[model samples]
Target: MFNITQWSLKHWLAAALLVFFALFPLSGDLFYTSLLNRMIVMAIAVASLNLILGYGGMISLGHAAFIGIGAYSVGIPAYYDIYNGWLHLALALIGCGLFAFVTGAISLRTRGVHFIMITMAFSQMAFFAFVSIEEYGGDDGLVVNGRSEFFPFGDIENNVTLYYVSFIVLVAVLYLVYRLVNSRFGGVIQGAKANERRMRAIGHNTYKYQLTCYVISGMMCGLAGALMANFSNFISPDMMGWVRSGELIFMVILGGSGTLFGPLFGTGLYLLLEEFLSRSALYTFVTENIAFLNDAQPWVYWQLPFGILLILVVLYARGGVDGFLSRWGSKNG
Candidate 1:
């Protein structure tokens, strides 16, 4: 029943990757599974960011604020013993949608750097607001009493189950985004992104389209936030901090903007590099062999190599890793 001819190389690769991930837990390592869960959740968030930034040409530095709101929606409710997973998810989506609708309405009026600054300001305001909430652990963050309940399916307490759920969600989000980007509405959004004046001249309400895209992106990120809270069993103001927002943007840019799978690759590569450098064998060797650096904190310097890699990617790989790979494959073919 399946037609292989209908699928592209990228689709095949995606299938293979999914199969690999599905069987990844056979290794019996919960740590790796947990890490992959985080990656999946983050991939969703980064993809949501890409929808607005890469395709819609809207740079929202406060995007993580929506994520935080989603997270806290779960955390705050759970703190009061409201353990319904579906309810938490609904609250997250609604809360994030309303916030994005209000903020996007205002932010869409600005362009370029002003949009970025306003988003950042909103995010900071959210971070501080969460910090000032005394009952929810304040600056220390809130620990979830238990994982979300899925009723008949039950809680996602098992690492493997959580990983699979997150993976399925990621796949769904990717497919949704792919469909959206290829749709007539998506064309209008992209056209507006390319040239708002032309789109406006053609009778397209650029503001409405952009705000709709923004709300959609925010809701997607909010879903990711719910998963994040479930993944860590903790929620904090730090989840929505400016630094996290910046990291999400970096993942989008590093993975190749406007490409559906780029964010996944970017998030995986960035997180993996961060993990590797933090406990790198090179760091160990340097600390052991170099006398002067023996007492130094090698982990502090882990970002140096990542920074260099980023610079190289930006300078040489114009379209990020995904674009570079596509070009390389085409050239070789």
Candidate 2:
């Protein structure tokens, strides 16, 4: 049996990724650095989703709602002149965790489609709440005046400083997830996924375990949301919408669920493809080489290609990119 207790210390892909991220900002392009930051942020969120979906066997469509909660966690406090970063992050995380725990407790009473629907409903409730925060900017959203200033550490508004902070958090979260997935609690959660009925019959309170995992996932995503709000220096209701939730799901699916590093790869590829296609289309339209696309915006049409790619991956690659890569490597070896 492969020892679950022992993990390869020299994880080549992860190590390579760490080196790449460290060097990316040295290129000094604001756009590239900013995009990298966004990718890392979304990657963290997607990893949070995988904890429940891949490990705990919970299908939550409203995962991004926690991120919305987190963003507003800091955004609202900042609006009220609470500029302490650590305090704001702590409050947001605690609030999101408590909210998720309450919601998950109720939602875990149901299973399968019912659980999914209930979670979706809860997320919608959050979406409406943000929209109703008229004191903050309502539908139009609020432009952030500046990011939280960490006393003595200097301004977090600087891109390089923010990037490093985000990178450290991402690494820290990933390590925490690694520990969680290998712990005693993780065994029960994975068993629950494989056979909840058997786990329950064995005297495990599966509902509690599931609820705990759900709340942890939410709190982690909330952290990502807080970082995102700071990075973008803005907050809006749209961040909590169904579309944002769908995007999180897509990131998980695209990256190959069940793997620790898959989400990072998935988010990177997804964002890069979007950027490249959009830029190419803009250049083509300006040059008028592609006659049919001259007046049409490329981004609106890029979804068609993305949709096709999703269909292909679903039909041909059941295990996602990680699975596909493993198979290829084995065959080549």
Candidate 3:
């Protein structure tokens, strides 16, 4: 009943990407592979944001607060000797969900720009709360004792194994998001996004739908944060900072917000640029004659490239990289 030829191009492309990632360990050095891990984790977070912004039409500037909640969920528990691996992750998701529920309830009361402002306010509140918690390294941040281990085998600290773990989780979360967006509930959310008045006219509770999507997005972002903390063995208030939130938004916008694979591409692009800049500075000494060029801090001027790229994307590629590719494909086909 199932024919490979009948599969959509997007499905085929997703399959190809998955296969490529599966074999990536064999094709690249550990450093590159680790960078891939970070990209994939951040992509998961960005995709969660896309669910809210692209699907629900809720523009949240403070989404990083949920991520911070997730990271601290694991980090703080480990510090207190209350670590139970998956249980910690569950708690983080629950915490983010509750936070989103409460915040969305309040913020959704105000529409458009006001909603964004209220969300920003709550996110700042979360940032300050983490800063005030003198224990668990407070402002400095807490280093994870080690990567969490899966039960029975209990050796998940291995880098390669962690890569596979993260990959699997990324795949699973993406699939879950796809299903959520296609379901009946997802239709309501999307409807609300397209036209809140119409959704209300159809007897649907638009506010409830928006709030639900917001909570779901927050929970997913929180999950990514928990994994990120475990991956890096560190957690800090910086995770919840406004700039970090902006970066996440940048990832979504760069990748093509509505496309499932766009966030992955965006995160990959951003991290690759970051890794390149960081490594370029390390290699600067090799060109001793460069003089002043070598003297400058690579990161100090990194924002120029990103800012320029953002301007280009906004002016030309409104739908982002994935959208650009889609347009190209349609023309060629």
Candidate 4:
């Protein structure tokens, strides 16, 4: 639990946001409710990446593979009528942990570009492996007939129930990451990131610490993937595609990789930008009003602006969105 005594501007704002989300379903807007669910799930996934990229100092281009594994963990079972929530979650955790362990063991042996490529290579291997299996619809993917069931406790019958469940998971994941990053294990990780030679000389066994961190991050992302599978009721290889992995990286960097609330805020802003450029009235305004350039579809070029903005952040912002917020958010604190 977070101490109120340490609450700053962003913390209070996050609390307010959570309160609003808690009460939001009462309004009964199904579209936005579902949208918020995606934001929460994406935030969870990105937060897992933060643990590796921000604190663990490892850059991975294949993190989405865990999410895919997690999704398939749910989807494959549902195909055969196994909807027990515990079973689904357990598979997600175990499958991702195993995958992470194998990949991290090999990837950690290298550093720089070699490390990034190996991790991605392993993720692509998983992607193709799933794609080759015809039992689960091959590249077409699998469908979940029903949401995961928890039996005596409850089941995700409605989007609202899933919404709250996902939100709670997000909070739990954040707490877990917060604790891990502040612990001695986290110290070793960041230390290795700073000076691997020094950490190794001090008897840290940096490789072991990093592999553990890698596995932890993968398991967390797997949880998000399970929730995502339940939410969308579908799973495809594209869910673990390299493009999606890149998006996860974008969100982490955009949100500030090492900061606690960065992923949450970053995912929110990313989705908001998607909404504005792709489905919002702003697109309508551009398509409907502009005189000589009416043929121009500004939404199609959405990434142009986003790419420019990201470049600015990379060049200018120290800690991404979190750093920018801290400047103005902690005046009184």
Q: What TM-score should be assigned to candidate 3?
A: 0.91
Model 1 lDDT tens row, 1-333: 037866555545556766777788888888888888888899999999999999999998999998899999889989998889999989999999999999899999999999999999888988999999999999999999887888988988777788888889898898889999999889988999899999989999889988999999999999999999989998899999999999999999988888887888789889998888778887677777989877877776767778888899889988786788777766755
Global lDDT scores for all candidate models: 0.88, 0.82, 0.82, 0.89
Pairs that clash in candidate 2: none
Q: What CA RMSD would you report for each candidate?
A: 2.0, 3.0, 2.8, 2.3
Over 4 Å off in model 4, which ranges?
Answer: 280-282, 285-300, 330-333
Model 2 spans > 4 angstroms off:
1-11, 281-297
Q: How many clashes (backbone atoms < 3 Å, residues ≥3 apart in a chain or on different chains) does model 2 have?
A: 0
- Name the candidate, 3 or 4, with the larger lDDT value: 4
Candidate 3 lDDT by residue in tens digits, 187-294: 998888888898899899888888888998999999888888888889999999988888988888888887777787778778877777545653444434567656
Deviation in Å, model 2, residue 223 alpha carbon: 0.7
Candidate 3 CA-lDDT value:
0.82
lDDT of 2 by residue, 18-70 (tens): 77887899999898899999988888898999899878878887887888888
State how far residue 239 of model 2 sits from its true place (Å): 0.7
Per-model TM values vs. the true structure:
0.94, 0.92, 0.91, 0.93
